[model samples]
Target chain A: MSDEKRYLKLHLIVLALVVIAELIGTKSYKLGPGTIVLLPMLYALLLGLLTGPKFLKIIDKEDMNAAEGLITVSVMLLMAKYGTNIGPTLPLIIKSGPALILQEFGNLGTVLLGMPFALLLGLRREAIGATFSIAREPNLAIISDMYGLDSPEGRGVMGVYVAGTVFGSIFFGLFAGFAATALPLHPYALAMASGVGSASMMSAAVGALVEIFPNMAEEITALGAASNLATGADGVYMSIFMALPMCEWLYRKLIRDRAEEVIKG
Target chain B: MKLSLKDPVVITVIVAILTLVGNFVGYKIDPITAFPGMLILFLIVIVGMWITKIMPGNLPAVVYVSLLGIILTMPWFPLGEKVAELTSQVNFLALTTPILGYAGISLGKDLDSFKKNGLRIVVVAIFVFVGTYLGSAVIAHTVLKLTGQI
Candidate 1:
């Protein structure tokens, strides 16, 4: 068989398996809302791991890239739907602008809080770039381009990027669900909390929120999407202009044994 | 004509069809009702992709599609109500499943890379997750308090 044919066959097989797994996992399992929300994702991850390099020959690098590309369509649709939902609530969403700004600060807070640990852990100065940024796909690209992927900073960023890509959704979903139920915060506030730039993580967090608050699902989703968009557009610039410098400054002040010089982007 | 899985055009078409079919089946919407919204979605995706190409920097396609969706469905626009009515029923949860599935699989494929980063990466990831979540939550809490939205 031609390579194309083989690739197509593998793609179809994996997709079929995934759909089946999702159906079975969701239907049969009587787990809690959080478990239910995460079931399909876990199933897919398990299937991929079983068929991945160390095990079988079902999926390869090329197939993975193709599958990743296909997800762009899903993301676009998800975001577009979010946009439509936000339409009716545009005025209210706008009025809640302070919350959105706060959300961005919170996103920045992650780097601020994470940087100290990264430096204390003896992570080189370059690692600060990756650790300080949001560590989404675009940030990964920017870091990789600025600091070669083989550099300590690149490794640090890629490590966070990979971890975020794999586990970010699950964490976000569970965290949002837990926060919504456990905390005194409003569901809409929790909803806005879901949008930390990564689309998949946002979806998972919103999904969990929907399970918890079905009536407010639309609002939660809209607010989450809007927050996500803001993070994506503004977060990048913020990371470059503000977050990176702040992290470097913190490292210099706090870390006594800082050897490597900070690479200004 | 031969279809190549590697061809982006072919991949896009396949994905579009699968998503449409998935939406209809998963959401159990009537084909007639779902068709218009699906068409609009497709147009939005295509246009979003084009916009991403021309736009400077790495502005995500989702941004454009969402922006466009917001604009088209805004109350001021003539077709806003109609478009909103048609697309409102498009259940996003059903749409997120397959995408998350793909993401899971892709993560598995990159397991080696993840392993290479070692356990310290896990620590960094934890901090990253905690910092972002807490930071955002604190801010959201304060704002909600000030605005009396909570």
Candidate 2:
């Protein structure tokens, strides 16, 4: 098929999905103190997955590749949309206190809980990649560059990167929604944490929050955008100097013979 | 394969138009009403990507797009309020629908790689996402309470 014909087909599929998802509209279920809000975005994502090659195979390789290329471009527009939200609320976000900057340190939670658990799960140096950071594109780039994606670290990062790509946003969406209702945390705080240094993940989490706290939609969107910006802008440096090194130290402390294991296995 | 600037720029325009349909259906905003704001945003997306293309280094286009967005919409910018007003009519949720729809369609090829990652990777992947999100939320909650922002 001609490239134009292929693209037209790909886009038409997406258009139909978008319309159907929007038509279904937003649905909210009350679970505990919080709400489990299912937005059209999630439905659109799931519907796309159902039609994709892994399941229905509605789209061919060329279509997927073409679609993949569009992601970066499409997301930039989304960022632009969200970025406008930041300007008017700049004062509020900054005034929200040191939490704006301090919350970034929370990224370390990955290694804190993930390291020992991944070790318990029987993963090796790969734990470093899996636990060091969220394994988004930037984190993945760091690992791939340092270890060349063929190393244990590379495999570890790639595994999570792909996994995150497929399911990470959905996880964030559900978890964020569930936590908002199940826990006693304030919506603003939860909003800030939704950033997690990745766009889709932040969007999913923020989307759920907006559904639950419609009153705070403006604040939720603003703080989430600001926090995500901070995380993304500063994350690469932090991962290289702080997070990666910390993960290495923890790995060495937990496993006595890093060299021996690699040699033996 | 290297990604040239052309494809994404074209796709951005396509998505801008696509988003209009979604905005109309979901948000009840007429396409004509959302057109101006969408045009402004579309221009920003293009200019931001263009800046990244010409600029040195490998920074993602998003960083530039985001920074430019903040700058152009800030109070000092002459058209900031107008821009904000027009764009506000275009719902944020509307923008996300097509983006994820595209993402969903693209997910099939990655499934094999994800499956090969095994159960352990999936478990660990969940841990990583949970840690980042929950950890940050907890910290934010604490700081807000301590500082009385919440």
Candidate 3:
């Protein structure tokens, strides 16, 4: 196939991957094989390869740059949904809310575990951007240009994002499992926790959690739906808050000075 | 095996159908139950893979499958009429959770290589996540509370 055809094909494949992930993760199958980790990663890797060369070229395109807008819409919608959903049960959800936020904090508390893994897992960072980009819109060309995923830093962070995605799932999944063992909490809490990053992964996490602990299955579904809406609503503002400083620090500490030296040459 | 997966059009057609079909079937099934929704999702994915001649891999794929299974299925599985009622009352979470996660992590992942400079970036992520969580939670709670909804 020609390059554009190939590119189009890749984009389509990525979309398919999303669909497949959505299907299997949303289902009730147990021990039938298939999990969340493989599908999306492969899709992302394929996306990266397809768009690697056009990364810079994509940046030059004008109307195609919808990164900011898309992210904003996605985040707001997610948060609004979450907030509105819990609006009725505010008292209970709030009583439980601190714990919910704390649970997230505890997961992040593992920054000790996460940092080293991130340092080594080169693809996670870019994958973070890529995954978000895809969620914003499946336009590979636009994502490539906006994030410059071809950059050394971009590549490095993609590694971190992928690793984070995997780790985040397992960590949260296991947390849910253990929590279920000890507490009166429900699986929705777990799914909500997992959905903290990628919806696809969160969907998978909720599916698995419900299957193993069939008792809490209902709670899990409610949480998953709630999680999606919550994240979608506040996601953009959160992104700006988190990404700006982190990217700045990474660029200054990792990418900038090196590029500066190259420029001087 | 690899050749089938490498085919882009095949992958796209397969996914689009699965997504539409899954959503359609998912809608048909009562989101209050788990089995039917889960089954439909599983069928779509496994069949999609089979038709595309691809197999599941380690880690990420496994997680994806497991997660998808739970998410799609739980909605349809009979979790008691309570779950059904509760979920319907709170379906807005569907949109918020995913959006926050996608954007938050997109930004969060940028933290990689940032640690090479020491604890500064990690500190930033901590503050950001905590601050945002609190900020959002406080605003959310206040709004709900003021409306006498809380």
Best by lDDT: 2
Task: Give each prediction's DockQ, rounded to 2 decimals.
Answer: 0.41, 0.48, 0.05
* Alpha carbon lDDT of each predicted model: 0.66, 0.79, 0.36
Query: Candidate 2 regions off by >4 Å?
Result: A53-57, A115-259, A262-265, B1-6, B115-122, B133-150
Clashes of each: 2, 1, 98
Sorted on TM-score, best first, the list reads 2, 1, 3
lDDT tens digits, residue span A218-259, model 1: 888988888876675556557666776777777777664343
Q: Which residue ranges in model 3 land beyond 4 Å of their true spot?
A: A1-113, A120-146, A160-175, A178-191, A208-216, A250-265, B1-150
- lDDT of model 2 at residue A256? 71
Model 2, residue pairs in steric clash: A34-A181
TM-score of chain B of each: 0.68, 0.76, 0.30
Q: Which lDDT tens digits does candidate 2 get at residues A70-184? A: 6655666777776776666555555545887899999989998888888888888888988899887556546644554445786677677657866677788888999899999
The local distance difference test score of model 3 is: 0.36
lDDT of 2: 0.79
Off by over 4 Å in 1: A1-3, A25-36, A60-75, A97-100, A115-257, A261-265, B1-5, B24-26, B30-33, B56-60, B116-122, B137-150
The iRMS of the candidates, in order, is 5.0, 5.0, 13.2
Model 1: lDDT of residue A160: 79
Residue A46 miss distance in model 1 (angstroms): 3.0
Model 3 TM-score (B-chain only): 0.30
What share of the reference contacts is kept in model 2?
0.75
